[model samples]
Target: MSVIRTAILGYGRSGSTLHAGPIEKNKSFHVTAVCDVDATARQKAVARFGCRPYDDYRRMLKEEPLDLVVIVTRSDQHCQMTCDCLAGGVNVLVTKPWAVNAGEAQRMVSTAKSSGKLLLPWLPARWGSDLQRLRQLVVEEQAIGTVFLVRRVEGSFATRNDWQTERRYGGGYLLNWGPHIVDPPIQLLGSPVKSVYGRLKQTINPGDVEDLFMGILTLANGILVQVEYTVSTESPPTWFLQGTRGTIVVHGTQLKMNARTPAQPSDPTQYSTMQAVPDKMLEEKLAGSLYGDEHQIYKEIAAALCGETRYPVTPASALELSRVLDAIRTSSNENRVVMM
Candidate 1:
């Protein structure tokens, strides 16, 4: 297959670690160009990949043609960058927390549609074996029974006081990390959120954004997905599904099955967090168990762009998830349930 020459708009952590690494490794795409206002980042991308670098994406797009542009900048920059890229007749793949609000996301979709360009904020975890296969089992196999409740928790050590503390730049835990933890429930429940009651706390860390958040979502499926987020937490994290038959618990990066058939000591580690860390030596065996599932995410995006698949994050789904976040903020303010 011929390579898809790509341009990356930002050389931040997402660009360097997430997008650059995979795109560099894959044969289907080659990162031909990069742009970053940060001199160090630009020099690194230029030197490391032997590609052209620019301080402004506008100038870069004007000078060099690219098939795709990866927007790995701050969340606040997504709408304009996407608009500019699409208007310049280039496709875009963006980092998640699609937009700071629903209106911007809708506008992005509309602009892309008008320009005949594709814009996707693909959350990679939804394609994992643990998530995808579990989605199949839940709806297909009726595994984990009825699934009365779904709970997702993302806890990390924020003691270092990273930048996710401000309200501007979409600097909050919700925008920084919520999309990955929340996508699975939306996929499994197959429901539109009808109402939301939520709460947030900032017990350990002091900042404009809440270090902890909890939201109760009443869905059209008659199931509830309770989302909890905390960066100040010290406990081991879990993403759990409870049902009539049994339960499925995703602890850290391990998956445990409890059902009528029960489980042996082994069943392949299909937990979603396996590929997040770049430790080649620590868990090679478990990583190998999840071989084909590695970049099911990029495959989903590539398929959609190649016209073989649809946008994985639909407009309504994006709106629903945004409403959930909105409700979390509203409920934190009004101290009441918010209608969707």
Candidate 2:
């Protein structure tokens, strides 16, 4: 099997740690070049990977014979860089959220289709161990017995002074951390996000962009998934799954479940409100890790490049995520619920 020559655009934290590190580890991918405007970062890339480093991505594209270009730049730069790479006959893998907005995402998708190049979103959360285990339990084993509600919360006390805190750079919890947290629910619930109600605010963060947000997404399947994030919280449940017969709560790496025995009868007349039935609850505790599957991302990209399998992050799904994000922004701005 021939190795896929790859180039990384942007040698910052994401480009270095997430993209370059994983590609270097995977045998199927070869890092041939990296593009960054920073001379220090370029020098580090050259020393670390012994690959060509260009200050201009366009020049890199013109010079290198690359099979894939991973765009790990700012969110605002994602669309243009991706389109440019596809137009240059290089397949593209962009980090999420795919673009700054839905319109840009659609344009990127259209460009990729016209260019006949594979465009994949680097959504490593799809292969998260905690989510994988949750899927096995909730979807396969029915351990939660018809899940009705799912909540994902990420909280930290942080004051970041970087591009990530700037609005012009597409810096906000909704865009930076939103894609990862939102993808799993959308994947599980399936689409036609009936409506979205959200609130965005900035507190204890020195930025115009919001540092905290509470978004309630009502899926067509009657599942209510709440996506919440805050950079100023002390403690919050990382994951919460509630069903008719049981509930699962994940804190840190620990999973605690409480499920009641004897499925509740469907007939309302079977039980009286005044009389209490004996409670038979089963409890369980499991430990797991929540880490992005960067290796899996590389594997999928390699397979897609090799024509062995289709890339999992479809354009439609990515567009849907963008749309949902747009709606959330609108909802927060207008102070009203937005319908999908």
Candidate 3:
């Protein structure tokens, strides 16, 4: 197949670093055009990639015979930009969180279906080394017997003044870091969520949006997944998983796990009189650096565009995440658990 001509809308950190870097390295894709509202960013794109740059994405879409358009703009712009690209007969790869709200997410999915173009969300954590290792230990190897809980925490002390801390731009821990932390647990559990409980607050940030958030999702299989993010704390373990017979902890790129053999049944008559003893535990640890580009979601975009494989981050999954996100917001506002 011919190289897929691609256009990226947005020249922010995510646009320049996450999308552009990978697309340039992959032979399957060619960065033919880029559009940004900022003139400086547009000029830089032209100088860096030698691609056509436009100040407006609508004009770029109209002029370029692009096969795929990657939307890495502000969170609020995701839905509308995706709709326009799909309507213009170009496939779309939207950076997560895919939309500002569930309603917008639904519309984007519908547009993609009606237009017969692929709508893929960029969820890099789904392929992250740390997450991948945890999945192998718990899901594949069953090193952690009968996993019961998964916890992910991301915390840092900072005062931000950028658009990231603004409500109008969909700036908040829930929308900003929610998708990255939430998607992996859903993939690991492999079950439908039954209920959601959440708490959202603005701590040290000077913006109107939330700087701290916690969400508890109970899956249909009874596994509880807790996702938390804060701008108040200095450090926290990035991941924690608990199972009936083992536990796993991760900090940055380092991972440590403890596993034990499940207790075997003793005499039924002694159940009331005998005291159970814990089994001998086994421990393992690893510290390694992540090859960031290996987790890039654009490779999947190229494969999907080439008809080589189905895109793993499907539109249905994106919609499910959006629904959960909306439910979390509602739960926080109403101070009650929301049933899914």
Each prediction's TM-score versus the true structure: 0.84, 0.92, 0.92
Model 2 spans with C-alpha error above 4 angstroms: 261-289
Clashing pairs in 3: none
By the TM-score metric, which is better: model 1 or model 3? 3
lDDT of 3 by residue, 6-125 (tens): 898998888998778888788888888999989999888888889999888899989999999989999999999999999999999999888989899999989999999999887777
Tens-digit per-residue lDDT, 191-285, candidate 2: 56899999899988887998888899999988999998877557687789998667888776677777655445678787744332334344344
Scanning candidate 1 in windows of ten residues, the lowest lDDT window is 277-286
Most lDDT-accurate candidate: 2
Clashes of 1: 0
lDDT: the better of candidates 1 and 3: 3
- Model 1, position 152, has a per-residue lDDT of 80
Candidate 1: residue 286 Cα off by (Å): 7.8
Model 1 whole-model lDDT (C-alpha atoms): 0.74
